[model samples]
Target: MIMKTEKRKSVEDYLCSFPEKQRDLLNQLRMLIKKTMPQMEEKLSWGAPTYVLEGRYCLQFAGNQKHLGFYTSPATIRQFQTDLKPYKTNEKNTLQLRWDQPLPEDLLIKMIQFRAEEVRRESLK
Candidate 1:
């Protein structure tokens, strides 16, 4: 019920939750997400940007006044821990990168690419 709507409208729900001024940063993030994980099915999981490959979730995104939230599987985080230092919120599995500043675009793209590939690879086995 609740979660079904969350999953179905993940990206749209998350983006529309934010104000218009923040759309620029969110759009950049969306583009990089697309560039990095081309083959994944993009959908909503808990009203966020959810990318799934072979039925496995690769990542999700959310926005607030302070920062953008990156909700992803811990396995994916551990796989690219070093590259994550700049954006880490240090909250176990979740990470938060700031909103006012420009994100480390290349690194994010890399992380997405790596994570998507990893999830798909594991699901294949």
Candidate 2:
């Protein structure tokens, strides 16, 4: 018997779809997320770059006309509500990063770490 497999779209392919300026920011975010958790899998989902750990979604990235969006869980958002005040957040699980605002590296690392742990914990249940 013969088996067939399909190739999946890579994160790099997704990043290349954006314009130069937006691509740069998306690349930087992708690198940061990779650095935070080297073991996570990167894939394209919902037309954006998404990171997953043990079959659980850890983070996602999207670009808009005005800002770059980093998405996580609502529980993670609530955990870092104070630090997120500088950026605009909507009912969805996103933290908007405008071009003018510097990326909050420390907070982002914390958020990623927390989400990774959360995903692991939930998977164990």
Measured by lDDT, the strongest candidate is: 2
RMSD to the hidden true structure, all candidates: 4.6, 7.4
On residues 29-91, what C-alpha lDDT tens digit does candidate 2 reach at each position?
889999999999988897778999999888998877788899998888989998888788765
Q: What is the lDDT for 96 in model 2?
A: 94
- RMSD of candidate 1 to the true fold? 4.6
Off by over 4 Å in 2: 1-8
lDDT tens string, model 1, 8-32? 4446666655676576677778878
lDDT of 2 at 31: 90
Could you tell me the TM-score of candidate 2? 0.87
* Residue-pair clashes per candidate: 2, 0
